[model samples]
Target: MLEQGRLGTRQLTTLTFMMVVGDMMLIYPSVITSYAKQDSWICAFIGVPLGMALMAMILKLCSMHPEKNLVQMARSILGFWPGTFFSCFYLFFFIIGASTHTREVGDFMTTQIFQYTPIRIIILMFVIVIGWGVWHGLETMGRSSELLMPVVIVFIVVLAVCLLPQVDTSNLKPVSDTGVVSISQGILVSIIYPIGEVVPIMMILPYAAKQAHQTRDMLIAAGLGSLILATLVTISLLVLGAFLTQHNIYASFVLSQKISIGSFFERIEAIMASSWMISTYFKAMIYLYAFIVGCAELFKLKQYRMLVLPASILVFGLANLVSPSITFIVITVVPYWVDWDTTLGIILPGCLLLIQWLKSYRKSSVTPNNSQQ
Candidate 1:
């Protein structure tokens, strides 16, 4: 192994939970609403099992390989040069993923809360903190997640519960009005995101203390995360309605403002925002960590910590250059990013798995023939 850090069962579970919720809280409602209209919540409910299926596939693939990560496993299955090419492509995915995630944090900060701050300044601040987290290593990040995840869950639950009274049942009237194709599209969008993005976690899973139960831990976390997003999307549709949720870029945040229990329990959007940022931090930091560690593995470097500074600088630069404004991310990057995640997370691993199975089967048959002869 190129890195030396371990994750407890709790740390792994919490980290997975946070990764699923991450930035989805910011943009998913509008994106899914645009796809399924009023049927968006239905897509959320359907995604739980389907999303876990995808997660289970990834986990099964990882467990079969034991200590090997995506990079090493690919190299072993494919020839060195071919695998290197594939791994290089994955590295590109990780860095770009990190950059775009960083860009989102900057974009969100400027547009919503820190209106006066320059985008680069906001990105730079996050890059510093995120880079600092990656600087420590996976165990450090895992421990931090264990501590912070509870607060995030509480905020998300509170946001949903507090906004229930405002939910208009009629907003969801004419449900299934979008028809099957549109609902499928919406469900696909919901799954490919957050769940698809969980691919990067494979790089760190080798560091987990117990491999036997990672699948269960991941499934539970993913299911919980899926349901939580479902609740948020459902409530967003019911409270803000399909029209408002589709139009509102920050539907979750705006939904937070809708809380009104005697006025004293209102204006707690900050609490919700904090949870989103924390999850985003974990997501982006994990990507960057994978990039750094992947680079170390690629170059045969002794440790990944040395690359942290340069990688952080690269992320900061790319984040600014990736898009001119938040609209580009919402309009252009958001949709395509899902495809990117699916390709890297699902398709690539599935291919590698099939190849491995064939090779094992062939080897088994050859051994029987040789023994009989």
Candidate 2:
């Protein structure tokens, strides 16, 4: 009971990994292929340091106010009205993110594996499981992360091993064919979608165990997770080739399909699919946690658990209504994600850090003189 809402460092690490590797592993192969062609892995490699820097900026901000969530700290620094407005905006972003993720999971499952069944069913089922995780609190979510992450990693390693024979070293030739401009463009897009979008994790930092090394743990988790993602994306490109990887809707899934062992061992897509499902489930749970917490903070509700059901309902409804089809999600939803996530995740948070720096400068300048007086 005492540990109900609290999360240990290892759990937090796993949660961070789960948050990143799921949807990112699913979409990034294709996104990078779209721009960099055979050079797509370059995008991931280029983005990693930039992504780590953005997260470091956020972590520094969190260090400045260790016990406070972004909502509370912003309100304290910006005053009540502006803070409340910012909080509302962030909460809205988190909820819309939940809806978007719900839709994505539904679409992915229905399109790839559950075609005969309605997508609505998939969405509802996902929402229900996610709601349960939300209600149980962040500790349970973190534990789930701990339990599921190893499986995800193992599957990734297995897939990589399987695809080794198929990898065409020629595919990686002339890696700079697109020049710096194209690779840079791919890096920019990849940064915003998967990495910049991690700003929401600031809310969970306060819930992590109160250790002096909390920040260190988080950074390590982020680094290791990014490496895993970068490696997977690189392998996908190498084995599948950029053109085939791009055309394949789920490039990672297709990569698994290519898995072969001698003349007999094959059809490991099911194992890959199961890993994806677990990874995606953890991801949806984190979004659901953010959504529930945001709702509680916004409404000044006493218990976040109470909002879980209504939030799930909201997520389920919007997931279905957000796009006419998966194609629409690709065309419309993704660009909007790239835009809004960049603004909130990168630009706004960076501004907050600047403001805090200025505030510290002004205080230091005046405090010594006032003491002399």
Candidate 3:
């Protein structure tokens, strides 16, 4: 392992917590509402347990491999070529995830927040900062997550409380009318978007100081983060209603607009933007870190830092070219992106777990037969 820093348990939990809350903060409610309408909060209620169960499976796979990160374990367990292909699959997933997320921030910033700035410039600057952070390495990002988590928590509480006056409880009244099918679809989407996204943490799990409580720590963090997200969804549905929540790409951003205490606390949507910005920062940094680590491990490089600058350049270029426009992503890309996230997040790790179990079973069976012979 080129990276030797150990993350404290708090740092590990913070990273897992951020995984569930990060970029999903702005878009999760909208996607869920689009699928389940008035029952979006119900979908959230259902998805948390499923997501935690998925986390447990990922943890089991990691434990089976001891200290090996995902890339190393893939090669070791699946054999050289198969593991190499698997490793490449994850590498692509990481860079593409980082690129797409950077594009999102660029689009939001240029169209909504900084209309005067060019998208390319905004993306370039964001990539530079993320690269700088990744260059400093895992420990710094771990600490940064712990620092940013409270900001996210406060932003959620503030948005929910301040928007209470505008919240129309009736907006959620037509619930369950969306039915099991739609709610199930919404749960699937929400599970993968932010909740299942914790699969990337496998890349850095070994960097954390191993604790017997690692599983508990992650589950608690994931549960807490999902609770925060579900609260955001409920608030959005109550305040913005299903139609507006579904139509608005930044539903939480729009929800923050309705926060009016004494009618004077208006236009402070900066709270939403800043909270989201903090989350997006973590998402991009972790994905980029994984991409760099995966590449070095794949090629047997001496150090991962050598790839950081060049990878940032590639990420910036890809961010600009990710889609024809933000509308394309909103309408055409997202439906497919959810499935892709699940493939990387759940299916891949699940396969790793299965393959390792098969190998262990074979070894035990063979030993028993050889002893009898």
Candidate 4:
């Protein structure tokens, strides 16, 4: 079992918010606007409830098996071989997810700030820091998030305020110009990439110090995170407009570049980048921690910290191999990646819940028969 009393509800909430927002904060505006046009904010709104439902499902599973994390629960409920298979699958999912986050951090730094720096160097530097956080365990990661999240929030608010003068409310007009089909597509993408990514919280939920109302806390965190994403999307639409948002890969970064206050507070994209880097680091750390813990559980190892280095090495290699280019990443995200996540996030967990329920029902029926006999 995970070390108890290591995390409180507040830390878990902050971690969830950071994980859900993750790299999506930088790129989602552009991706959603490409599909939903000026109504990308609407996609965020639509995705909120769906995101909550997904979170609730994962929380229910965690609540059912409070003493065990997802990997352990799978093993106990699904028997040895089958459980090991699913656990390994989840491990792979987290590794791939973490690698993508790693690549995203490198891509942003290389393209936006350090034009001459090699991407591999950026990836190495980031992985080392992330690996350090994971090696110390979840408490360190949680505390780091608690300290950094406020700064991130402040930077985001400042960026929004600075860009207010540039906002064109008319840019958000003709809201449904893309029609229902396109807007629906955007909503699905929004939920899948950012909101639905909260599935990994299942692994962390068992570690919370206060577990009495964890489900409620998780939903609130996820809802608040979605709301924040919606606010950023709205800001992006108003300031950058739909056309520019769709064309720019890092729309929020581009939005930050537009921030200026009497020319003295100009070029504040560095601040924006820093906030994004913080969010991405926490995001990657959560995924990396999950991957490490899951592997330890799968192999029945007592210490997960030992796996951190090898895992980081594997993730670094995969980050470069899996994402050859941003276009390829985008192409895969919509069709293949989202669907795969849905299977692990919803379908597999749902199946496990059903099996667990059946087992309980059978046990109850059997007990009644034995008493009668």
Candidate 5:
């Protein structure tokens, strides 16, 4: 069993918000723009409901066995063999996801900030910081997020305000030229990338403080985070225009580069970069924490921290090996990541909830007959 940790509703909210908004800073606007053109913000708006629906399903599963995390609940509802198998799959999924995140940080730094620095050095430095955070445990991570997320938000709002003078509302004109099919594709990508990926948050839910309502807290956080992302998308579309936004790999970073508040406050991309780094660190730490906790529970280990170092090492190695080029990562995340995340995040958990409901209904019906006898 995973040890119970007391994560307050506020901490959980910040953590969820940070996790969903972090990586979206780097990749989301560009990809969504590619699909929806000037109407990319619409994709983000449409995705919110789908994301909430997925969260509702995972929350239902958690409600069925509030005492157990996703891994343990899987074992309980599916029997040992199948449960272990699925739990291992989740571990692998988190590990790969974490690795990709690590690589993304390295890629961003190497391309935009440290062009001459070795990618491996960037990845190692990032993973080391993340390892330290994971080692400190969930309460520490939660508290850290609670403190840092507000600062990140402040920076984002400041950056947006500073760039307001540069925004061209006409850039967002002629909306939906991409038609319904393309807009739907953008919506799917939006849901998968940040919103639907909240599935992994299920691993942390069981550790929340006793009085906390995990489902309500997560749903609210997810909604708020999605709104923030949609707003950012609208800002990116207005400022960068669809053609520039779609082509740039780091659209937000490029947008930040455009900020020049009367020539005195130029080169504000550093602030945006700092915000991305902090938020991405929180995301990597959360994913790493989940992976370690899941592995410990899978094997019934005494402590999850014991696996942290080896896992970090594994993640570091895989980060380097995952793709030879940043373009490959971007090219694959759309169809590939959407499919992968939808299966694990939505379908599998939804199935578990359905099965658990059926089992409960049958048990209740049988109990009445037995009592009558």
Candidate 6:
């Protein structure tokens, strides 16, 4: 069984919320709106049901083995060889996710703040800091996310509210002009990135305070987070319009630039930058911690700290190698995310659920009396 004092259901829920809105509030609006157009908000809006379904599947798997993390539960349900192999696959995914998030932090900082700084230096700094946070363990990660979440939310809300004067409704005009199929396709594209990314959360579910309400809290967190994401997406659309925002790489940052209150309240991009930085750092730490723990579990290590430094090196190196340019990063990550994540978040969970049902049926057929257990 996983150790006690992992994380409470509420904390896990909070983590989920922060995960969705944190770093994502920076890039998602621009990319999603790029495809979905004036109706891009509609894309995220449609994601509500899909996101809930994904969360439901994940939570059900967690519920099956209340005390086991995804790696452990995979072992129990699939037997030794298959489970071990799949666990390694998950570990790779976690490591890659850590690297990708590190890239995000570096790209944002270098582009917006330190234009001349090398990406390697920025990535290394975060990797070391995140390595330290992960070494502190999950409780510290949870508390830090909880403390940062409110400040992040307030910053976002202020930006959204301030954009009220600049909004242009006509920018969102001609809804569904691209036809139902196009809009639907765009929605599917948009949903794949954010909602499907939740697959990584399965690793953390066993840490939830109460197994009984794991699904409940997962849904709650997914809901609250999606609501926040969709709201911000909508606000971005209303504030900047679809055309201009589609061209701007950091739509949220540009929107932040537009927030000026009668000449006194200007240059608020710094606040948004600060908020996004906190979220980005937290995201990097969370994924790295999961990767470290997963490695420890896989190798049967006594403690996870041993791998933290080496893993940080690997993650920083990979982040540096990811993209030559931000545009290249965008071109690559968009489609790759949709395809791979569909397999991970949607297909993988569905397969697990179906296999569990089949096992239950077979056991019932073999020994109806003892099968009750």
Q: Where in model 2 is the C-alpha error above 4 Å?
A: 1-4
Error of 3 at 169 (Å): 1.8
- The clash tally of candidate 2 reads 0
Off by over 4 Å in 5: 212-214
What tens digits encode model 2's per-residue C-alpha lDDT throughout 1-373?
Answer: 1124888888887887777676777777887678778887888787777777777888999888887777877887788789889888788887777788788888888888888999999898989988888888888888878887889999888888888888878878776898888887788876676667677687888777787676777777776667777787789878877788787768888888888788688888888778878877877777777767765765667777778888889888888888889998777776567678788988888888898899999999999999999
Clashing pairs in 3: none
How close to the true structure is residue 2 of candidate 6, measured as C-alpha lDDT? 31
**Candidate 6 per-residue C-alpha lDDT over 1-373 given as tens digits, one digit per residue, 9 for 90 to 100:** 3333478766787778766665687888877777778898888888877787777877777777877776887788899789888788778877888898888888888999999998888998889899888878777788888788888889888988888888778888888776777677667755566666766677777776664666677787787777777887888888878887778778889888888898999998988888888877876677777788777787777777788889999998889887777878788876577677777777877787888889989987889666665
Over 20-86, each residue of candidate 3 has an lDDT whose tens digit, in order, gives 8878899889888999999999888788888888878888898887788888999889999999998
Instruction: List TM-scores for all candidates, in order.
Output: 0.98, 0.96, 0.97, 0.94, 0.96, 0.94
TM-score of 2: 0.96
Candidate 3, poorest ten consecutive residues by summed lDDT: 256-265
Please list the C-alpha lDDT of all candidates, in the order they appear.
0.88, 0.79, 0.88, 0.84, 0.85, 0.79
Better of 5 and 6 by TM-score: 5
Query: Could you tell me the TM-score of candidate 1?
Result: 0.98
What local lDDT does model 2 show for residue 229? 74
Q: Better model by lDDT, 4 or 6?
A: 4
State, as a TM-score between 0 and 1, how close model 4 is to the true structure. 0.94
lDDT of 5 by residue, 92-123 (tens): 88999889889999999999999999999999
Positional deviation of residue 136's Cα in model 3 after best superposition, in angstroms: 0.3
Ordered list by lDDT, greatest first: 1, 3, 5, 4, 2, 6
Whichever of 2 and 3 has more lDDT, that candidate is: 3
Counted clashes in each candidate structure: 0, 0, 0, 0, 0, 0
Candidate 3, residue 79: lDDT: 95
